[model samples]
Target: MHDLLFTVPGDEFPFTASVVVHVDGPRHVVRRTAGGDVHEVECTADDVDRVVDEALEALLAPIQVCRACGTPSASPDFTAVFERMHYICFHFEFEHGDADRDQACGLAGCPAG
Candidate 1:
């Protein structure tokens, strides 16, 4: 089994993001963390690159709608989460909108109303 870690930082998050990738035979696991929150996911290890790509897509794919105005954000900031010793892309907050309300539009808890 192989393990990998990464740090993602940007203006949106304003924090150091941590991600971990684990490859074990046919099972692949990822954990990621940002802003003190953690999230993880698992999949078949067809290929390391493929698994990472799919996992990241799955994490960022859900922010198509603007949780604050329900109008779909033109540009969204993305990040990841962590679990114990693993990580994956699962944390995100919307940008380019009402700065007062944007902080409330996180991917993990968007009212989308």
Candidate 2:
């Protein structure tokens, strides 16, 4: 389990983005969520390059339900996986659930905290 911590700013909200990549027998499992999903890619256990490629693919897969919003993103995959996931996790933290809405969402149009 890799715990990736990021946030828009102190003013917006706080959230954690996590991705776990682990070998389970013959495949590599990629897991993350803001109550979203997990993905698995097939690869040999010893092939580091394959493992990385599979992991990145899993992370970059287009979402039917965007973690930032229920609808599909306008332009997804324009950024690095971590950058995109960080925004998703941050947005979800503030926009969903019992969130404090007074602050800017910080996904866009806000000072960097």
Candidate 3:
């Protein structure tokens, strides 16, 4: 297993997570300081790529963009999850929020709602 540390922006600040990737396929270990260890299901290569992309976004320290107007959120973490729509993109406020969502681009500043 190759352990890699990825830094991401938290609600208040930046944080780092340690990801131990198996040389083989599927299983991996992910741990964050605030949230402790996170258990992930068997993930595909696409999932890994997505996570890496998110980390890169955090590196830029981007203000979360509104799912509606493409506006960079002035107060991203404070934006309410108004009318949970779908995965337009970015700022994963909730992990399971995308479980039953559509790709509609209209929910005000609900960045991850």
Candidate with top lDDT is 1
**Pairs of colliding residues, candidate 3:** none
- Evaluated against the true structure, the overall lDDT of model 2 is 0.44
Question: Model 3 — which ten-residue stretch has the worst lDDT?
Answer: 82-91
lDDT of 3 by residue, 8-66 (tens): 33544344343334434555433333246564434566576665544444343345555
Clashes of each: 10, 0, 0
| Model 2: residue 61 alpha-carbon error in angstroms | 7.9
Pairs with steric clashes in candidate 2: none
TM-scores of all candidate predictions against the true structure: 0.38, 0.26, 0.30
Over 1-103, each residue of candidate 2 has an lDDT whose tens digit, in order, gives 3332222222233333234556655665544433354444444557746656445444435442344543444455534542344454544564444544555
Ranked by lDDT, the better of candidates 1 and 2 is 1
Encode model 1's per-residue lDDT on 4-92: one tens digit a residue: 86654232444345567988878888877655777777866556577676445444344443333333343434222221111111222
TM-score head-to-head 1 vs 2, winner: 1
**TM-score of candidate 1 against the unseen true structure:** 0.38
In terms of TM-score, how similar is model 3 to the real structure?
0.30
